[model samples]
Target: MIFYHFGKYILLLKSVFRRPEKASIYKREIFKEMVDIGLGSLGIISIISIFIGAVTTVQTAFQLVSDLIPKSIIGSITRDSTILELSPTICSLVLAGKIGSSIASQIGTMRVTEQIDALEIMGINAPGYLILPKLLAGVMMIPLLVIIAIFLSITGGYFAGVASGAVTAAEYIQGLTTDFIPFTVTVAMVKAVIFAFIITTVSSYQGFYTDGGALEVGQSSTKAVVISCISILVADYIIAQLLL
Candidate 1:
């Protein structure tokens, strides 16, 4: 059963990367789904980004002052962490939770209902049609989401710094700029793209081959989230190592 399910997943992945000779009619559809996943999921990403930045700033300020560390570098620390790790890795996990589960359940349900099979009968490349567009969308939108995450997080951190009396708003902003690196954004963008692809592709695969009935759909959804979460963490470490 495991291999039966995984075999399809591997094949779908191969199909996704297949050359022009292997490409099918489903690529555009996958792109549209990607856009939907990205645009639709923006709210959660925005809310989380703001709060995470605020909390990190608050905590960093408290610790720096409380621990008698250099106060001026607080903003730099916050900025670096947000751009390098927090924004990309954390946001990917969020997407895995919000969008990944949705992809799994929706597709899994469609599978159980025989819609995927019908598409195949109609000569559609079911995997390409269902999975590719979503995968592409995820790959595309994740970087945009990460960029937003960075901006919101940094802004929130600045506010928190002033509100908490750890640093003046201007000082906090100044500290952030001193340590700014353009490549950090590129690093984050790369990570977001990879993470997006991982979550979307894995979730879609789980959904694509879901079996049994509604129970199986539920199981697939749970598995999709679990696997995606784990994959995100693993991929983060791997990608970070590769990039850094």
Candidate 2:
């Protein structure tokens, strides 16, 4: 069954990547999806990022109880942690729940309502028309969101470290600025893109193959979120191992 679903998912991806019937329409749809996936997700990302960073900073400071250790190390730990793992991974997981479920439900509804059938009747490339824009948008916007999340998380760490008496402002700033690796950012971006692709394509696959009616649609949505999250975690570990 797993092999069957995997084969079907691969076939669906091929269909999704096929040439679109109209470039202009696809472009318009792409922009709409970008806004929906990016802008719509900003609020929750912001909240989650800030708190995570703050907590990481506090916890890291708590653990480094040695008087011999510099307080600035807290900032370095928080910065690296956020960039390498927290921002991209956590934010992607949250988005898997938000955007994945929405995509599944939307496509599942269309499938059940015969809208997808109607598209076929009209000679449209239904998968290309329905899923391609989402794929493109996810590829583009998710990285941008990760960037924002990284920045916000660091900022939050700074404030929390200072306010909580965990680290001084000057020490935190020095730590954040010092010994930073450019490659970490590259790895994060790579993870962001891969996670984005996983979320959009997996959700769309679940939705496109949805069977039955309302109850089934709900099931598909739930499955999409669960699968997307699992895929994100697996991809995260693989990327980390390969890159770092």
TM-score of each: 0.90, 0.99
Compute the lDDT for candidate 1.
Answer: 0.83
What digit string (tens of lDDT, one per residue) describes model 1 on residues 34-69?
A: 668878878888999888899988888777745455
Q: Across residues 1-244, which tens digit of lDDT does each residue of candidate 2 receive?
A: 9999999999999999898999999999999999999999999999999999999999999999899999989989999999999999999999999999999999999999999999999999999999999999999999999999999999999999999999999999999999999999999999999999999999999999998999999999999999999999999999999999
lDDT of 2 at 175: 96
Could you give me the TM-score of model 2 versus the true structure? 0.99
Q: Where does candidate 2 stray beyond 4 Å?
A: none
Who wins the TM-score comparison? 2
- How much is the lDDT of residue 187 in candidate 2? 94
Q: Which 10 successive residues of model 2 have the least lDDT summed?
A: 70-79
